[model samples]
Target: MDSKKSIHLLYAQYLANKISKDDLALLLDQLASMSTEELALLTAKFHSSEQISDLKNTEFNSQKTLAFIQDKIVVEEPRKRNKFTAWNTIIALAASISIFLLFKVIYQKDSSLFRATQDSSLSSISNQAYLSLILPSGETLHYSKDLQLLSNNSLALPTKDVKLNVLEKGQLAFEFSLEFIEKFKNKTYLIATGSQASCTIRLMDGTLVNMNGKSSIQLPTIFSKEFRTIALHGEAFFDVSHHKTWPFKISAKETEITVLGTSFNVKAYQSDSHVLTSLSSGSVALDNGTHQVKLTPGMEGYATKSKGEFNTRKISIQEIGMWRSGFFTFHEEPIIDIIQKLAQWYDIDDIQVVNDHRETFSGSLSKDKSLTQILKQLEKVSNSKFEITERRILIMR
Candidate 1:
């Protein structure tokens, strides 16, 4: 039988409490191998089917099944050779299944879950925003409003301030405020923000990082006694804690920024051709392997992918990290670049420029404004027309 049919049969057996251990393992393995699109389709099919509904109403108990599955996962995890990848996939599968089952129960009791909003399409787009935490053991944890709801209702997820400590041997330790602690650690952890989403993280040593949309940062759970180092992709504003004995370092694409204690903004998205580091306070040294430059407050250091050399220019201190303050500030930025920024913030996929306008614009706009409102302002300033259809935008000049 095909994979979907096999999964359907196995799931039905599970709901009826008749699936064997081998079949349950097979089901999870197959589900893990499927792509996100495939899994979503399967979920929709399962939810719409009368057979599954009948089984759920009559025979299925979510709590018992969840416990059984958790036990199976614990038993099977040790058998996998590539534990990291396998464990992450298994955890994601478990969460997906748990949420799917739980949502069914919640929906039956509360139809308010499906209530429509005025801007349903915009709501759908916003739903795609998320923050992901990848632990060293390859376990991935996701945080979002929707996931928070599910977690609050059923999952024992940690809420509020939590500290992470990296332990030896792929173990991670979580220190929760309520004196709840757990041992799960690795040397490094990755924090990522999805499109249209931003997040702030406080490092163990009191460094504050404000991440932009579609950005990622990788740092050790605990900094070494000598120095603090972290890798960055995309963009972030960092407020480094003053540690007189230890220096802080950021590794971006083709550039390394070292400082004692200072506030700075770094934009190094891999898709972009240039890496930019703007200093707001104190001093920082930027090295791009071939060349090095020191930047003081009000100075911006940039390196192009083609030249891969450090270049410095003076920029207004107020222009640094404007996004963090709910504003988009552009200073003679190319029209395409401006549109791309909007696309990243709005999570819009389809963008078309009707004419090849090499116009550069300089202005500031509030992020609180709607896409249409912002576009209208841009049209007035740049003498360009913007047409929005759903999540797609067209520009003409």
Candidate 2:
């Protein structure tokens, strides 16, 4: 059952004076997960119900409601210390009282909402745009995508003389020099893409890395004698140079992808629990020492650190690195996972899913369109409804 639906049911039962202590505890936990905007929406939605207005006769303990919500936030997920803000706690408490009071009205007037599912809609919304480049000197440059790179040597960045050559979108070319090559032999630099941005980088080794939005890669100034290793925090499509002796290796959390010279896409964000690697051509080995799997063209490899399991299955060739190519491939994927992708690409925070979404959905969306345009397409497939605010997105059912 959806957590939000469970909360409504529990709220109804509580108003009827029949809720158990366990149900109340669960309700508090669910409420804590909701963002402040969502809580406000919940209160405002039922505030207008005629049935609720007549529920003034019902009595409730305000102090106990506040206490329960506060206690839950403190102790519920001790490991998630960064999950809550001071303002969110205040919103939760305010929501708790409003929820406790409004249920009497909702139960009496709008009981049908308990059985309601989700609907999605889209309106005009805007996303902030900027990309981050961390130099070897620890200085950061937050530049817009339209800004061109003026320097001929891509590796000679973070310098005042660095120039911009506004190349066409999705174009990546790296011109190297023996002097510049020697300069970056052992040094490392970082590149990060924003919500509305994508970048193609040519490495010192002639390898091309096409980074998707909200993705990052850390590359060395020079490849080691034995291996060409890079660390990835998000998603990227790699076109590696063929080196029989110096194989390309990518580290994403607990998983490592190794290939001699191949084209592959890796989606392994640090925030995500599972790391996904899809090979378009050439053979690649996904290894974490304890478990290893080899992927062929049109093959997808999935590994979860928690389970410590590596699994492989065949997918379509088109699905590999579709985002960079301009589309999203969602197959048996959760709505939350999809939203996380949007959050990263859009540079959005405060995404709230009111209900538990155990259902999986499959489809494709174009990346060329705006956020609202893509969301309207999403509404046709999912049971959840979308409410886009100034920057936050609220999902309800």
Candidate 3:
């Protein structure tokens, strides 16, 4: 068979579970030679309504599927075999499955219910010692700093310990553990930090992300040759990897921040009125179709979700990133707003402002303090007093 038609037929047979051992090897050998456009077409095929419906209803068993694929693979001596059977198909199957799962992951990523129902072990805790790592194949791994390393390899460590190195000037460094690097190429991952916890992660492309409490980020499965992109929910500080040809872009709510190389903080909690993008260094452009704003170092761009409009202003870079340094820096910020942040950082669920008094706080408070201690400090500064009840905090005048 000619190469082009063989490529089509090979995929067709594999999809139909009719591929022979020889055909599998042939497809494997040609995978590296196939252009990205050609592979994109195959990925598109998996998105058809019929295929998508089947995938949604089917329970995918990766181990069973791999075992079946392995049984069909055979190695043959070059002198005794044809071109198709010169090498075993195991390597080819691994590559093929990686591509197939990459598409499948992107397909199911938008399901809010699926994201909400991750393993209970990862989500049940109100406070977490480590960040939750959601694998592209929908596995959850929890790692803490207490883990002891037994090997130099990232994956060979005894436990999944995500390490963070604090740097000068509010910058943090994090490297993906070995287990993660294995799936880094073709799969995207969602890293989530709990309400009482914050974490820093470094993407495969060297972009550093400081995820605040109750925040999550959807990292691109693959940083495309054309652009590097990520989607954010809640808040994060991004130290982007610069590429002159490939700009780094972050999509948060209705607003998008595009930068070639810059450090910025984005806040887009679902409950907030505006999406805030504050630049720490270099330059960033914020866009929401109807409006656009360019921000330089020590400036912030705010986009109102309701109006789809944007505005810019000068801001303090230290205030923008103080949360990473275990402090909440407020500058005449509303009392309710401060309470909301306190609730999120401390995992206090039933916080209510009983009085709608117009009071704003302007100061910095250490996050390491207890809830009562911080509340007492705030009360000493503002007109509000805190009343602690059973599992609730009431702010009254």
Best by lDDT: 1
* lDDT minimum window of 10 residues, candidate 2: 116-125
Which is better, 1 or 3, measured by lDDT? Answer: 1
Clashing pairs in 1: 171-184, 171-185, 172-184, 172-185
Show how many residue pairs clash in every candidate, following the order shown: 4, 12, 2
List the candidate 3 regions with Cα displacement exceeding 4 Å. 1-48, 51-126, 145-186, 389-391
Model 1, 10: alpha-carbon shift in Å?
60
The models' CA-based lDDT, in order, is 0.67, 0.65, 0.66
> Over the full model, what C-alpha lDDT does candidate 3 score relative to the true structure?
0.66
By TM-score, the candidates rank as: 3, 2, 1
Model 1, position 320, has a per-residue lDDT of 92
* Per-model TM against the reference: 0.58, 0.60, 0.62
Over the stretch 56-118, how does candidate 1's per-residue lDDT look in tens digits?
322122333555565656776567457466645555554446454544454334322111111
| True-vs-predicted CA distance for residue 144, candidate 1, Å | 2.6
Tell me how far the alpha carbon of residue 116 in candidate 1 is from the true structure, in angstroms, after superposition. 40
**Top candidate by TM-score:** 3
